[model samples]
Structure formats: C-alpha cells, structure tokens
Target: MSSPQRSMIAKVDSALTRCLCVLIVWLISASIWLLGLLSLSDLTMRIFAYGEGWSDVSWAELSFMVIFAVLLWRHTYYCRYFAIGIWKGMGRLLAFQGTLACMGLVIAVFTVDVEQHLGASVGLLETGADPALELGELGFILLALYLAAPTSVAKRLSHSPVSNVESAHTTAEKEFTV
Candidate 1:
C-alpha cells in the first residue's frame, strides 16, 4: 500500500520473473542437449547392431555425432552464464555453434529415421507417433534457434547502481572537457 512497500513488491516481482525466465531457458536448452545425447546413443547402437564391429561402422558419421553431442552438452552448461551476462563473447560463439548444432540435428532428424531408432530402442516398434514427435522436436529446434539468437538475452543483470553513477560521471567529464 505504501510507496516503500510497493517498491519492495516490484523488486520481488522482477526478481521472480527473471528467475523464471532463466529456468525456462535452462529447461529448453537442456532438453535440446538431451536430444543430442539420445541421437548419439542411437547412432552408437545402430553401429553395433548392424555392423560387423566398430571398425565396420561409418567413422565419419560417428565422429560427427560425437562432436554434436559434446557441443550441445557444453552449450546447455554455458547458456546459464550467457543468460546472466558472463563471458558474452564466448557465449555468442557457443550460441552460434548451438544454432549450427540445432541445424545439424534437423538434418539428422529428417534423414536418419530417428523415430524408428527411438521406437526400436524403447521396444515400441510402431507407435505411429512419428508426426507428433517430429513436431515436438521441430518446436524445440525453433526454441533453440531463438535461444541462440543474438538479440535475445542481451541485457546484463547488474545489481550495482554504481554503473549508472559512473556513466553520468563520464558524461559530465566529456561535456566539461569539450
């Protein structure tokens, strides 16, 4: 009701909103990474299931999957820092890589019959849920792309008010010097 109480409520509300946003971003990013991991496992299983041995498998594809999985995992871990405005340059680079990884995932999803692999692995031969699964994955991929975007999550959360004071001080210095 009072001014101070209103101000406190506003601060608490903003903090809660920020935390919720971060948690949502984390869930999305982590889910994407888990998809990558699942894909990698499927590939590994297929290699062992059909091939005479590991040597008979396609090394190139296997290696690519491994790299993709690692990138996704790392991106999932680092995105939290990125969201909080730490190591922005590294975050941008990782985000770009994450975008590329998502694209790679798109290709893999379409080309590799991921549903079949997933179904087989889980002992469900024909659930007929391919369309739904694909749509969900596509949605997640789009979310990943959104997370990778440069404009999103650009604002740094600074608790200190000194930055405002410092900027004003610099502006005053410039005006007096000129």
Candidate 2:
C-alpha cells in the first residue's frame, strides 16, 4: 500500500479498536444495572409475599430503585469519551458490586423455594423450574465483570499525570540547556 493509504488504514484501525473497547465497557456497566433491577424485583416480590398488611411497597423496592437510579446517572455521566479519566477505579467497583449481586442471586435461587411461593409445581429438577432467567443473569454478571477488569488493551490506555509531567520537565530542561 502507498504511504497515505497505509496511514489511513492505521488510523481507521485504531479508531475501531477504541470504539470496540468503549462499547464493551458500556455494555458491561449496563448489564450490571439490569441485574440490579432484577434483584430489586425479586426483593419486592419476597416482601409482598411474606409481609403482613404490605399494601404499599417496602423499603427494599425504594432502596433498589434509588441504587439503580444512581447507577444509571453515574453510567450516563462517566461512560462518555470525556469521562475516561475515572474509568479504572469505577469499573473495578462496579464489577465487584455486580459479582457480589450475582452470588447473592445464586444463593437466593438455591435457598428460596420458587415453587412454594408461586404455586408452580416446578422444582430445580423434574418438569422443573425454567432456569433461563437465573442462567442469563449469571451470564451477564460474569461477562460484565470480565470486561470491566483491566486487560492488556486497558492497561495500555492508562495515563499517569506524574509520569507525563516528569517527561515534560526533562524535555524542558534539555531545551533550556541547549
């Protein structure tokens, strides 16, 4: 390829790589928010099923709503191109919370009798409970965490102001000395 053509191709390739990386991260964060929604639903259901005179929604629903709302707001604010500075720590925290939520869901699935509450004669086995929802939730959780954690590409993107400043200082000194 000609030099101009090669340069264009390289630029396109880098742009595509950056876009793909960002999309992957955004999807992970969105999945975490979705799982939080599902968890809220389950908690609400449990409360209504067991609580006496529970005509109104309980604190669990409200809390979950607040949590998800805050998450959405944060995701919207931080997922933008200009907001990449805080992504490293934010991604880790989000991944940790998502993993914990998934574990809690697993424990709930195994411990809580879905059949007893819903009158659906479905156990974990036998003409059993449809595990799709649980499986999908787990899949989302795991995949999201995997994407959020630092990989080689992510490490390459990390920026350090101290290192940058030191390098700039050395360059300035060299220019002044010359």
Backbone clashes under 3 angstroms, per model: 0, 0
Tens digit of per-residue lDDT, candidate 2, span 1-178? 6654468888999999999999998887888756655554564454355566545545644454465556545544544543444655465546565666877667667645766677775444454434465444434544443444433333346668877866766766968877
User: Whole-model lDDT, candidate 1?
Assistant: 0.56
TM-score of each: 0.35, 0.37
What is the C-alpha local distance difference test score of each model?
0.56, 0.57
lDDT of 2: 0.57
Candidate 1's residue-wise lDDT over 46-93, tens digit each?
446555776654554456446546655565565664564445544554
Cα miss at 12, model 2 (Å)?
1.5
Can you tell me which runs of candidate 2 are displaced by over 4 Å?
1-5, 54-97, 100-122, 125-163, 166-178
What's the CA RMSD of model 1 in angstroms? 10.1
TM-score of 1: 0.35
